[model samples]
Target: MTDNIWTYLMVGITFAIYLGIAIWSRAGSTKDFYVAGGGVSPLANGMATAADWMSAASFLSMAGLISFSGFIGSQYLMGWTGGYVLLALLLAPYLRKFGKFTVPDFIGERYYSQTARVIAVFCALFISFTYVVGQMKGVGVAFARFLEVKFEVGVGIGIVIVLFYTVLGGMKGITYTQVAQYCVLIFAYLVPAIFLSLFATGNPIPQLGLGGQVTDGAWLLDKLDTIHTDLGFKAYTSADVNTVDMFFVTAALMLGTAGLPHVIVRFFTVPRVKDARLSAGYALVFIAILYTTAPAISVFAKTNLISALQDKEYADVPQWFTNWEHTGLLGFEDKNNDGKIQYYNDKNPDMDAVAASNGWKGNELTIDQDIIVLANPEISQLPAWVIALVVAGGLAAALSTAAGLLLVISTSISHDLLKKWLKPNISEKKELLAARLAITVAVIVGGIAGINPPGFVAEVVAFAFGLAAASFFPAIVLGIFSTRVNKEGALAGMLVGIVFTATYILCFSVFKMGGPEDYWFGISPKGIGTLGMIFNLVVTLVVTYLTPAPPVKVQEMVESIRYPKGAGAAQEH
Candidate 1:
């Protein structure tokens, strides 16, 4: 390890600043805790939302997935960022105008039934729980490496710090802290990317460097394409993935981003509907900065990785080789005793001869794709501080997302489920206390789940988006636009839609329910969630038409939510 005292000091100072802000901004009322008293400026809220939305998976894991998946990975980049567009066009402004404290509140009232609200609350809790697990796990990994602590210890430290401010400041504390986090994460993500770009391609801009020409006068993408094809791998910039699945995956992600309970709650912090719209635009711009750079980073890293290992002997490899090998990340087996690790697509029949002749044992480099982005700084020989910053950025992404998810979970339990349903007469202080307790429990469960993450973090995350799209997005949109949808229709929609969506995902993903050979037209888990969304929309519409219209009073409530001025007071009461 590099004996860089200053890097540790800087990291320490950053953490201290975050703690101080959280304490200073602690919320004083239910309003403060839930929506920061609806006083946030559009720009500030936009920045905070960006921080909340761009989690550890985005910062630390996405580029790595891209690096390994090649052209197939662009779907993630496009799906995630493009989802913002759908949010802007379809959901954000109208939901902000509704002026509710929580998603379940809208669901309950819009459907004119407590049952709908309770189901909405359960949906929010489940989605938040699943998503937060990944974020907390990310925190453990980053802290373990950077702070030199055991993974569980690091998770405990993180849980304590998050609980302190989250309980104290509520939405108020989390919002401002998220602003700081946004800066830290963006700086952390971009600096290493810039350095790597400059080092490998002599280019300053990562986006251009990805496709730029190298010293050998070949375009980077062209070279990657050549290598991948030569090794029986698909082209780096082109893939053979199904177009329909791609379309739905992209659509589901976009709709899901718009529909996520925690993200939507942030828009409520803005003062008006106009601010909500403007804030979505700003959030997209903030997110786009990283999204645009990420693919470039992926391309560069993959190209660099292959070139570094092409003909190098095992013993001659750098210290990183041994270090990663110890972690079970890098493996080498010389099949023919050539003493050189040959990296090729083992699945490619054309490369089998090369593997046999060159003594390459089925391309033995087993480094998990998730490690690729974090490994970039080291690969490019960036300074120790840059590497340290990467650690901080990973933490920021994980923690910020975890904070947002916990808030959603707490609010749904305390405000929507308990205060609204179980104990309508509960005092504000008790509600606040309950919220805190819920948050603590949420953190503990999330941390435990993090220890044994299900599937790759990014792929599993796609399920949350799909769930939101199928269940919440349709209800919210129909609630806002069509005043006639009754409680029965919505309830039927959510249940049927969720069931179909879940069944579809489980079918292809876990149960082999579809069969050993068939896959509903080859819809993989990564893209099947999109199909689930479509099923939800259709089920919801069909049920709504068949059911009786909502009572006139419920129609009036929908009308009231369309305008910002009158609905706020009623929601507060």
Candidate 2:
């Protein structure tokens, strides 16, 4: 049978498992819908959080970026995964002890202001919506490529799957479902990585193989650097971006990871504040399994790709090459028409001399880095089963994250927006219904976005992080550490952070309103959140100093949440 058979079988099996979990663990009360009844075990929640955090960007895009960008890409591996350490130590426990259904709820109560709650809800929606669009688009791309369906149909299918589980069982279902997704995604990610690593180097372990000598007894990094230079590209292990830019970008991503609403809500599902800390540790271990492997996979995929295509006769190119080309993700032009292909950085001035000496016309290949993960298996001539598994894995990643983000959107709408303002006297059953209704609407919006996505997952997701870091991270941290941060200070800080970050991103990245010099201090819009966070901190402190301190009762609530000594069992209202 063709690969599509395995693709259908594996994807169908995974979806069935998810739906089964949803049906088995259906949510009844608001607490169950929002926080999985606050009873999940640490290990189970850990796996769920890993799945929720990884998303399509981590599973599909990171390796591709690292494959092309090389050494500088390590920042993502460190910034995104290492962030869990910061979360475990800094944020998770306090929020867990506060024992809220959502991050905005905690923010609202902690600040003791409805306006602060509203600000948090808005920030949460913006960040979660930005993230869900990527996942929904990933679902469309994965299904289109693997299932041989129209892109629209694939996206519709994905949205329906998510709506069925999330609308039906809410966080309670998503929690267990994500555990299964974690298993499927991790297995699919590791299998090809191990095979490719063993093929490229003598070592079977990918982390060690990344540093190990190649078949020619050359250090892997050394060999890649040689290839990079020969192709008129920067050395594979060199920093392509400026140092200051990378530092700010990495810091923004780290803070964003700690602040993202959906990921933060995972700890709320666990039974106790201590379990939240332990779950962060366990979640980091699960995430590290992939984060550590991705760079190795990047090197392996890039090296294998160059080796396979460079200087090879066009007529003799493999079917996988032609397959991807048909999708327009990979392209070629027979410029020289000498029946052979040449792939290099033709824009490099030094390449003009090389092209002249080799009688080459121009660079013929145009491959999008986003295609690397999906195409890696095909390029390796791996078994059809493996390719199908990767398709399923990509779906798992996209679906798991979409489910989480949809929950965030829904919870905020029902709990923070409607429940707080319109219908304070609503019953538990009606609240559950409202949450489901909100999910249906969110899924429709997300599907529409998937049809016309904003940009690449990695790039757009960075913007989401920037928004989260700028809007929420500072206020939340200050609220915990300093009881004096009153409502006006928190509100002013959020408005300043969000407006500054959004305007910066809109000017530079979205509108292309300015060039590199137009960026503030040469910091890319993606990294501007670090500056925004600092601004929020400063403005919040200044405003707090200018205003009266928080009332005594509010100060006591902050004090109660600071320590874990009497955290007791997780309590839900």
Candidate 3:
């Protein structure tokens, strides 16, 4: 497909808009850089938060996971969207009312100790760094594919783009740019889904298209279930999900969403506490648009792939097939020399025998299922501009997330560490310069990591979520609502939670020693972090009771934060 001029024009227009916003809303002070002067509208803040939350994982990976996993993939759908609900009900309002520049600030002042703040800062940094690696990798992948450049060069370009606005505009610049990104990504995601749905099932809405009958008047999911079972794969609608693991993954995702420093910090950008609460609902609504469409897209893409490939012989495949194969995304081997692509359960004995009899060795079609969603338009013969838009949308999703995380990381180093710890009397000008330097260094490191990510992007993100769930969620929740919670307890809780969660993940995930055979009490490291959260809650409550209550002055400050109406309020500027 030729590069469509319309797609290039659209992408160019989007870039110009982003650069314009960065120029218009450039930050001049610490407050502006950190929290966007706390003057963003509720709706606008909601859009920005949606953009921040919907990273490369959401845009590039979620539907792919769903396509491969079927109903079991609902875990991601439930876990990710349900998190916004938990944030809306449990965290957003109170945190916004607390009105701080950073999440660590709340911890520092709430516990009346620098120790609590430092610990929170560390957790924030850990979660942000791990998550950003995935986004950076995503940026590299999108750019490499769309621009036909080396992965490292794509990563460097992505880093430079994020650094330009992130250093200048901070949260203020990010907020507006993210709003633009949200538009680009959502349109890019939905357009093809709608086209595919209409083409396949005569329905524009994917949720309906998935369940509605296909052209043959059979329910799409039911047909998919039949095909899946025939190939020894799990049913489309009746996947086997471990209840316990499902519960933990869902809960952990919720806690992590509420605990994420970059996301929670967006609430502070709103002008009022009520606005924060309302905006969370709006964010969820915006996110749900894509979430609801994802399942349909998953089913559609999977069905289309099987139908397209089931009858095509290896020697007769088209140019598009070889093109994708060159990218290492599609592969096949005629193990038994039948010269046909056999796609089935590789481990299923019955299916293996059948494949062997037919001169096939296991499931030889080696296409990565994750490519389905992004490649849907091309597979279905959509216009080139639509393809280009997909490229732009993916880049937007990745860049927006990277920008947000870079801001959080830079703030932690510049404001929390340098000005607060080492040099208390640093001038404002020096502080701003330090913040930019920190951002530059961070972008460089992130770019390098993107070029050579240490682990699977999905697995790393999961671990990051687990870490946040275990460490920051408990401390933040207790800090605001529990007036009796003291410094000793909060600090201890953070340390214990962080240590336990890190150890659990490290043992199983990094060391690879905690599979089912070696799992501790049937709790794998991936799920054990949820257990750590319970431990944190218990330890914090018990320690708080055993220790003395927070000082009266601290209690008064908490009360003031809860209710607003004073000139001494923490102003953004």
Which numbered prediction scores highest in TM-score against the true structure?
2
Model 1 segments beyond 4 Å from truth?
1-7, 148-157, 323-339, 506-517, 563-570
Please list all clashing residue pairs in model 1, or write none if there are none: 26-169, 27-169, 83-254
Per-candidate TM-scores read 0.93, 0.96, 0.94
Off by over 4 Å in 3: 4-7, 150-153, 451-458, 521-525, 563-573
What would the per-residue lDDT of candidate 1 be over residues 104-183, giving only the tens digit for each residue?
A: 99898778789999989987887788788778767766665555556667677777777777777899889999999999
Candidates ranked, most accurate by TM-score first: 2, 3, 1
Q: What is the C-alpha lDDT of each candidate?
A: 0.79, 0.86, 0.80
Winner by lDDT between candidate 3 and candidate 2: 2
Q: Which 10 successive residues of model 1 have the least lDDT summed?
A: 564-573
**With candidate 1 superimposed using the best TM-score fit, by how many Å does residue 559's alpha carbon deviate from the native?**
2.9
**Span of 10 residues, lowest total lDDT, candidate 2:** 564-573
Q: Return whichever of 1 and 2 wins on lDDT.
A: 2
Task: Show model 2 residue runs off by greater than 4 Å.
Answer: 150-153, 335-340, 358-361, 568-573
Models sorted by lDDT, best on top: 2, 3, 1
lDDT, residue 64, model 3: 78
